[model samples]
Target: MGDYASQHSFRIAIVGGGISGLYCALAIHHHCTKAAVSFKVDVYEQAPEFKEIGAGIGLRPDAAQLIHNVGLGDGLTAIAGGSGDMLYRRFDDGGEIVTVPLSREGSVKLAPCARSELLELLKGGIESRGAATLHTGKACQRVEGLGDSVRIHFTDSTTADADLLIGSDGIHSQVRRQFVSDNATFSGFIAYRGVVPMKSLPQWPLPSYSVAWLAKHRHFLVFSISSNEALNIVAFVTKEESQVVHTKESWTSTCSRGEVFKDFEGFHPSVQDVIKLMPEEVSRWRINDHEPLDRWHYLDGKVVLLGDAAHAMTPHLGAGGSVGIADG
Candidate 1:
């Protein structure tokens, strides 16, 4: 097997139409193309449409370098500001904290990319490469090991059989659900996140970086997500609002600015002023965490977990998205 003339030809079945799934297909495709080997890749997503949400991602130089290595530089650079900076402020007063110039530390290319923008760019690139198939609205119901091949059954009444089955479905992954009874964990606090147009902030310059505001009640985050996008804002507070949240499986939902402003009363009026500008509720989620499992691989001879499906976190370090992109 070590000295065979024919390289191993791969047929990959990726479950989940999220970034990790798409990225996996892309990676496999690029590798086979480089090796001049034949392979097929397909991704299954449960959504009717893959609409990128209001979340903003913070990427370190290492993460950006990884994207470049995958030959996604142009697409990454398109919706991402690789030359951005990082700014900080006090949560209460909105007073200026020390500003840190990111991306100046050697070959680091950092930027805040809107989750939607990143998805659009990544999906577009995947299609342009002609290396993978994305089947949106097709949810993976089951993955069964069938000797040398794996069988993938979907809710859409279709199935795919491939040499390798990948479960990159995400935190509440059905693949994970089938593999283990207890995996996901609750991290104990909920996050209220939203974005306001720059036009909403007349006192600020076109923000050239990301900012973190720390207060007693909760910590707030603001950053410029993309060139044409709004200024991103997120607040992580310890409230019993989890009981008030609408959905059970979902982590986030939309809320009015008044709801969020109530928590930051003693802080700065500038903060409340900013809140008043928001038109409506965006998204909120009660954060959670899980202990790393001994076995990420499962199902006799097939299936593997990726992204939050594998490792969920509280995201206190601003590296959650960075880590996810790095995992990709």
Candidate 2:
């Protein structure tokens, strides 16, 4: 047996219990068990409880297949909504642009699901496998390398040591800051997102397929989630970098419906109607991404980065979450 195989027990500490963190835990457990290695994983989150902030995410076929390969296929199938071609149209005249099929013959279908629901599914997978111990309300303040092991210092003044530390935290990752000198850069884009009940849009024109309305410097995307009971709408607008007021506060904020309406003024009536149907307030998110790093691990691979912490990108293709899942 190799030296690693002969080790008595391997300890892993995962910072941030979001989708990437939890999914990484499951992946580690799956691989360790297959290799007949004894391991323990600890997942730490800054939130008081496990919750996802986003509305919905569309997982590409490969990401869905990754979940299936990780043994959560049944759980994902239960919560996943339908998938088909993505229809594109012009925002002004509502002219059809093109239809892009998300899946080819014999390929797995796209999986659109609520972010919260996907988190629940991943948490359930962790629970069923007894893969990791979840720690909430424990924010990571910093990390220290101890040559042979890594020590994590939390905001509560507590500490934990593990053989390996994985940072799956989102874009503003504390772990990444510990080693990498660079930070996330604003992508010159902002997105306003909301969910509207399907029942409210009785005269909805498009089919159930995901749709995008294109225009100069902006686009609107809509797709069914929660079993087609609700539509997730995202309005993306390009903004001058100087117009953005970047802060340490939460990246997501609520904006008045008037602001959204003003942004989409002169759009087609169908697009305007959908905007009107949205709630009085919606979430505005400033999109940010990072330049590719020369490496994802440090301290001889004892410390590593995953998901957005490693490679954050604009959600133009709805591949961000799926990329995170693949990182796991």
RMSD of each: 3.1, 2.1
| TM-score, prediction 2 | 0.94
Tens digit per residue, CA lDDT, model 2, 272-293: 9888898787778888878988
lDDT per residue for candidate 1 within 200-318, as digits (tens), equals: 67575425536677776587777776774577777777756456456233534566667777766665665666667666764667677777777877755467777777776667876
lDDT of each: 0.70, 0.85
Best by lDDT: 2
Estimate the lDDT of model 1.
0.70
lDDT of 1 at 145: 76
Winner by TM-score: 2
Q: How close is candidate 1 to the true structure, as a TM-score?
A: 0.88
